[model samples]
Target: MEKEFVVIGLGRFGGSIVRELNKLDIDVMAIDSDEARVNEYADIATHAVIADSTDETVLKSLGIRNFDHVVVAIGDNIQASILTTLILKDLGVAKVTAKAQNDYHAKVLDKIGADTVIHPERDMGRRLAHKLSNSSIMDYLELADEHSIVEIIAGPKLEGMSLLDLDLRANYGLNIIAIKRNGHITVSPDPGEYIQRGDILIVIGHDNDLGRFESKLEDN
Candidate 1:
């Protein structure tokens, strides 16, 4: 069955989520207190309504509990965000994800039973910093404080070398989880698989190890 989602707050973050979900053909209902914002996604989302999610009566009338997932992306309104999340949990929503403005907000969301609390700004800053520090790194994602996954394009030195020859795990303590070549991805590539220049390698490892591996690629 297709999953249903109700996204409250039509800010940049929430708007992006709704658009992406729509691209995937998912059912999404977009809601916002601002009539202008709600109208913006009216033609895009499955349903768009101008409603304040913090009000219990408003949520109950919307039948929010029937949705598989609910996302509270209220911007600069921590009280509303917290209140909305608490009401969703109280109504027995299957999953609730909330955007946290800061550490304290995240803690409150956690205590109120938010399934996921995301710091989009902080996470995006980290990703941008990683990309800025390494020219070879195409993208970065933080899995944990010390662990990360990165996509790096193979350079001259990596061309024609098989995975067994490079021995990335033994040499740099990094693992190439997958390789993308000519738009096709090969997951868990065999040791004998030869790496070609321009191939994009998706590697996961400790931040320090990833840094060291990136340095090696730079030196080559």
Candidate 2:
């Protein structure tokens, strides 16, 4: 069965998600309080409507609860975002992902039964900071407050070193969950497999441990 998604708010973030979902051939309903914004996605989305999502009647009229997932991406309007998320959950929506403005907003959303709360700006800042901090780190994703998954390019130090010999888990308290080499990805690579220069290692561990590992790579 095809998954159905409803994106409330037609800002940059929400619009991008709708477009990507459309490209994947998923059914999407785009909503916004502004008529111009709704018109912009009229041809792109399965359905596009101009309605204030904070109003329960408006959401119910659209049958939003029937959708597989609903994204409350009301940019800058924290109150509206919170109310929309709460109403969706109250209506028995299967899943609700909300964008929060700050830590307090995120905490409130978490308490209100939002299935997922994302701070895109903050997350992106952290990712960029990590990339700037180390030349080898290609990307960084926060899994929790203290843990993250980082993609690091293998350098001269890592070349020809087998996973067993590196003993990443014992030595650095991190795990190489996958290795991307020449466009091929090996998930849970064999311990005997050797790492080649330019290989991308997907490692996950506590942030402190990841920092230590990056330092070791830099020294090599």
Candidate 3:
């Protein structure tokens, strides 16, 4: 079955979602107050409506509640985004995802019952900070405020240690979720598998503990 999506606010984020979903052959209802933006996505989406999403009557008229998911992507107007999400939920939309400007905004969205919240700018800034802080860290993702998943090259200290020998879970509470070696990936490798000097480890765990594990690699 094709998944149906209603993307409110045809700004950069909303526009990107509309294009990508349409590319994947999913049905999308694109909404925006700006005529130019609505025209831009008219052919790309299943339906394009130039209307104010915050107005409950206009949204109801467009049958937005029928969509499987509704994404509120109002960039400049947080109030409009919040109100749109609230109306969608009240109208019994299946799911609502909102883009938030900051931590406070995310909290407000959560309090208002947003099914999911995205802080793209904050996430990007954190990744940039991680790269600056540790030249060896290539990528990072926060699973929670305290925990994260990171991709880092095996440094000198961990050159030839096997998974069992490291006993990562007992020693540091970190899990080696996967290993990328020689352009290939090993998911959930056996305990006896040996970690090579240049192998890349995709690990997940608490931030402080992961930092400790990285420092241990430096010590070895």
Candidate 4:
């Protein structure tokens, strides 16, 4: 079976997803109540339609239930976003990814059965803060249960250290899963592998452990 996606609200978030999916040669349907916005994506999306998604009958007509995934990215209109998500779930859409305007909105989306709730703005802010606070951290991603995956640069302190000598998993409850160097990546490097200058360590651990690891790195 061919998989398909439905993007409601042809705003920045939704529109971007549509275009990216198109670039991947994936089937995507773009929808917006605004005629102009819908027209803007007509040439880009596999299908573009101007329709109010708040109405169940309209969705039924569009055969929305059969789509593999649906993203409700109604901009600024929290009520519409919530309503559309509710309708999509009620219609048994397999996966519903909704953009939440804020924390309370995310909670409601979760309670109402949104498979994934994203705060793009808030998440970007947090990600930037992590990088800024610790120059060693190039990137960070938050995970459930207060865990995170981080891309950190090795400092002079670790230049000659091997994974075995460091014993990161035991000492800091962290795992250096991969090493990136000079645009090349080494996955699951040997325990005897020594760290060199400019090596980027892809590590995963609980947030507290990560924080401790960062502080320890900064001290060196």
Ten contiguous residues minimizing lDDT sum, candidate 2: 211-220
Best by lDDT: 2
Best by TM-score: 2
Name the regions of candidate 4 deviating beyond 4 angstroms: none
Question: Over all chains combined, what TM-score does candidate 3 have?
Answer: 0.91
Candidate 1: which stretches are off by over 4 Å?
Answer: none
Model 2: per-residue Cα lDDT over 1-220, one tens digit each:
9889999999999999999999999999999999999999999999999999989998899998899999999997999999999999999999999999999999999999999999999999999998998999999999967999999998888899999999999998999999999999999999999989999999999999999988887783
Residue-level lDDT for 35 in candidate 3: 99
Would you estimate the TM-scores of all the predictions? Answer: 0.92, 0.97, 0.91, 0.94
Which pairs, if any, clash in model 3? none
Separate clash counts for every candidate: 0, 0, 0, 0
Candidate 3 lDDT by residue in tens digits, 90-205: 99998999999887888888888899999878888888887777756779898867899988888666778999998889999999999999999999989899889788889899
Per-residue accuracy of model 1 over 185-216 as CA lDDT, tens digit each: 99999999999999999999999998888887
CA lDDT, every model vs. true structure: 0.94, 0.94, 0.88, 0.94
Ten contiguous residues with the weakest lDDT in model 3:
211-220
Give per-residue CA lDDT, model 4, range 136-167, as digits (tens). Answer: 99999988778989999988888999989999
lDDT for model 4 comes to 0.94
Candidate 2: regions farther than 4 A off: none
